[model samples]
Target chain A: MTEAIQNVANPQIEVKDLNLWYGDKQALKNVSIQIPKNSVTAFIGPSGCGKSTFIRCLNRMNDLIKSCRIEGEVSIEGKDIYGPGVDVVDLRKQVGMVFQKPNPFPMSIYDNIAYGPRIHGVNKKDLEGVVEHALRSAALWDEISDRIRSPAFSLSGGQQQRLCIARTMAVKPEIILFDEPCSALDPISTAKIEELIMNLKKDYTIVIVTHNMQQAARISDHTAFFLMGELIEFGKTRQIFENPGEKSTEDYITGRFG
Target chain B: MGLNAKTSERIAFAFLTLAALTVAGFVLFILYYIVSNGYNAISIEFLTEMPRKMMTEGGIYPAIVGTIYLIIGSMLVALPMGILAAIYLTEYAGQNRTTWAIEMAINNLAGTPSVVFGLFGLAMFVKYLGFGPSLLSASLTLGLLIIPVIIRSSEEALLAVPPEYREASLALGISKWQTIRHVVLPASIPGIVTGSILSIGRVAGETAPILLTGAAYFLPRLPDSVYSQFMALPYHLFVLATAGTNIAQTRPLQYGTALVLLMIVLAVNFVAVLVRRYYRQKLKI
Candidate 1:
């Protein structure tokens, strides 16, 4: 754990004693972790283990849900995001998110990518370039450049998911949160998104929630294991997968118990 | 011990065909009766000219213009208020006791009798506001009458928009108002237009509200302003059919007016269907 923390000089996101509840039911229990700057950190847990809930808190997506209550500090770039006077809109701009399912707006593909930048009031002079850049970053520009005006729903399922990624990238967020982004994709599309994530690490800090242990081991530099609302272990991806410090982490990675 | 499968299948087919033909036959019989009686009087003179002094020679021009005025006026008043109320109910208001109560109130308002609305409109707009028995007063009355329909339909349209769209916009750091303006409203425009058109159809055909608040006699000229008195098709037909002294003489004019009104209503409905189809095609891509 110390070696993993030492490898990265500057951390991008530091969550301290974060707890979340949905009315009377608690979802996350005192989760604390440091995510390194410009590195991929994967959260691995079974379904309903609060991994998705924790990611939603990073971008304030949980705010829209009724009966959701979040506690403790979640900070990005040394600023506490949940502190008083924090504008959730500004926080979301800095921290973008992709959902598990592909949810393109019922509009054209160009509009879907351009939507974020347009809302944030990006100048018209720069919008065309920005949209192109985002789509390119998501590795979807080549297939879609000729027919950008086509409706987004015309795209294949994998393509739609990539378009969602492009939409997130258009806003130029510092940190991107992914909630089981590849869970709905096949092996081919999943591999493509994984490759895109690896490339994206050079520019954006990524926090991913994935049920696939192999995916977490393959793409993430740092990994955190969660089970039943508790953070069981956190370490370098290599260490966590190869030789975990805790028995529970080993058991989960080895398919002993989810 | 075995059933005759082929015979049973033939019997079922025969029963289904008979039931379908029965409904079709009833509808066609009513349509044939209305059209044969209404179609003979439809002509250029019967459409463009006003009712003659002798009560036999002219058309339903005044009533046609009055129906248009009443429908347009009602739409102008009801559409904005209905959309705003729907937005407040669905987007801003929490799903609590107050919202539930409001929803219940609107549903009951929709179920209220048209005559009750006419009485209410007479008391409120005519007696209290002193607008008089004019086009404006009638329009206001009809507007109140159709607001419940608009509210219910617009709310349903807005609700039809998936929750994922809102979540996506919020996750992109867009403000709630901005999200609704750019995404939700644009997607729901087809539904809104359909609802508005349906409400307008109701306004055109409504007779009770107009009877309570509008001019009972035919006006030679079109209404010059919102407050001016005007003759509507429904009121004109009612008078021509029932109260006119020369019933045998004015019967053609009455049938002509009814036909024109039916055509206008049908045209409006056709346009709504076309608009919906256009939007559906656009949304499919």
Candidate 2:
């Protein structure tokens, strides 16, 4: 056991004693978890259980909230992200995010996909290929190929979400954080996004916060069930669902409680 | 009870309709009065030729040109500062007492009278900066007067851009400045442009701001430069109606000048509407 602790290989992201507060109200309390590389880890909880808040900590998205104060260490690739010397821009570059609602920028389809790369100093010569590659990876290239110059808002909700995914993919982040990405989509769109996530984990570390128990069971390799700002259990999705070691995790999975 | 509800609803509808029509009626009345009195005075030569004699006989071409210059000049000063301030307030500033104080100051500044701004300009730009009674002084004054309007309008526009968009961009590992430039500004440009057009219209028609700062009673030629005092439509109209040697004789000229100023403002508003429509279409919002 001592040898195991001494020589454990670092996970892609390791969060230790992560705590967050919005003004006086604590939102996350002592959350410690290790997310393996090239795997989908689903954060499952009911509303206000800190699942989303915990996921947001991975990329420092909570910094946008005026009252949010974070404590403890969040390391990506074994480097402390909250350390003084860490460049937040570079940290964010390695940790992309997708939002709950589809928020395609008010621009053409091509411009939407090209926005991230262009800002990161990708020249115009390479942008065309980058945009195309991102779109294809997000499974939207075939549908939006002809309407590349058309406004992004012209697409359906499903297509718009896909475009948003493509936009995030353009930055080529190693880890992609999804904050209820399919919460606003139709079931068909939700299914498509699920499939996309499953396929994406082959190349990128994916963290998803979801309310859907079945979704976490279906797609995620690893599952972490949260209850009232505490992680109840963390293990293989199958183990957590079929034979959870914790009663709370079993209750949440069986829909008896959240 | 049903009959009472219906009666009250009908009365409310009537009041709302009357209120809306009253506004439209006043606008129509003003347009009719100006156009009727001014139409005979307007001609191709009147629009093209420079004024002759004691500001009574010829065109307001110089005033028209000067007004355009002032509008463009003021916009150049106000637009960038206002937009940047708004972005900082909405995107970066924490919800603290300092941010609240700055917001309150902007609101108060917007409420400050144009004439007060004119006096401030006289004391500051004209006297202290040594610009004298010139276009530079007047434009800078007008720009100061409208900065609050730009800031308020752009702030509202920036706020109206859904937080979802900002979050989505930030999640992509894009920097804050990049997100604002690419997402927030593009989404909010139409609103900013509308505010700018409103400011331009107000600046074009304002007599009080230019009275002390820069407008000339009559300048023979176009302003040689920003340093030169220039004729402006509002001040020219003021001169024609009240200060000219033959105020009665130049009554038609007053109406004509008023009509021209109104036309210029309307043209600006029309362009604003077109630009807004074009972006709305392009963005498919």
Candidate 3:
């Protein structure tokens, strides 16, 4: 597996010997993988598997959990994120996240996009351009450009989700993590987001966690299957969907069991 | 079983509607009683002139000024202290046994009787602290009485702010304090302001606390400073109705004072309703 993955250039994020516990219960066990630069990687698994938990560990989102305990090294661009003197706040700036729900702040549309830039102390003069560029990148500018001053809740659910993505982009993050980004949207909205994700891979490293197998096959370059706190298989999306390496992976993929 | 369920549902709906109507009826009854007895007594001179004849012959100007002073003074002390304590309790405090105990204590304090707070104020501020029976003492006592109310509501307001906002802000690499200032506090402002206004209404007409700490029997001149003894609307009404030598002659004045106090409370409540409506429309929530 190492020889097969070594042919590619140095991966953007390297995870090794990762283990996690929620108080007395173990949630992730010995999970290790490499994420390539500027590509889409999908973590697909059944519910209660550690796929969501693993994705959270990428940017230390799980640290917000009171009982969560982690033991492993996760490095982004060769620097160990858990190493001494590293600030979690600064680390998150490089790795943005979109939650399962469309969680736009109950504020103006313009204010929602400007929140990140304002936090970073960006000049007022530059915020207008930044907001425009971010909305344009998320393919949302044409729909919402005229009503930028309106409250974010005025947007449709799908538009709100895209606004969230644009908000993540406004911070200029190198990696964007989506935790079931389209689970709340209809099929049409889901298709649009999938297209956006494919186009986003040209400049940003995208990591998505999804329960939908078709979505994983549609947009992902690499796919990792998790089951009961263990990574069963990690390979190209096409190979994993066509010829899974493990029995558990094939059984789960073929609808034998979740 | 279906027939029984239908009858029971109709009975419950009727009972609930009756209960709501009872509340509306009580409010209307009070408004009618106050207005009928007090409106005839309300004149420009009755409002602006100083009381005479050892009881009541003129306006309650001094009491009105003193009430305003006390409200401003107490709010100066209570608002910031209560808000800060609430923020500490909700935002920074760890979820532990100690936090639970503190919350329990605050809830119990809010339920404590008004007169008990008066006793507390008399002992702590007037006697021990040597503030004496002056405007400062009365204001401080009232401030303590209302602090629990403020803390309870402010904590609720802060908690009502969605956790998702905090998560999103932190994910953008914003510090916890910055997130609170820019996102959490802004979103929660409507709740906080409404809570403060409600508390203000409760504190405005309070007589028990001020009766012990300040509430002079007769003061023709306005309170010149915080240290000066003062009269207040509720306390003045109490004097005219019960303690006055000419009780029969002062009856009209007592009703007038009560009406004014009620109007002030209604005005504060009206402002709170307006603010809530405006924000609800703007936020669309």
User: Against the true two-chain complex, what DockQ does each candidate achieve?
Assistant: 0.71, 0.78, 0.69
Q: In angstroms, how far off is A106's CA in candidate 2? A: 1.1
DockQ value of candidate 2 = 0.78
Model 3 lDDT per residue over B210-235, tens place: 99998899988888788789988988
Candidate lDDT (C-alpha), each: 0.87, 0.88, 0.89
Q: Which one wins on TM-score?
A: 2
In what order do the candidates fall by TM-score, top score first? 2, 3, 1
Regions of candidate 2 where Cα sits further than 4 Å from its true position: A1-10, B1-3, B96-101
Candidate 3 per-residue lDDT, tens place, A1-258, comes to 444433445599998899999999999999889899999999998999999999999999898999999999999999999899989999999999999999998889999999999889899999999999999999999998999999999999999999999999999999999999999999999998999999999999999999899999999999999999998888889989998888898998898898
1 against 3, candidate with superior lDDT: 3
Q: Which is better, 2 or 3, measured by lDDT?
A: 3
Give the alpha carbon lDDT tens digit for every residue of B210-268 in model 2.
89999998887999999999989999987887779898888898898889999999998
DockQ of 1: 0.71
**Local error of candidate 1 at residue B4 (angstroms):** 15
Colliding residue pairs in candidate 2: none
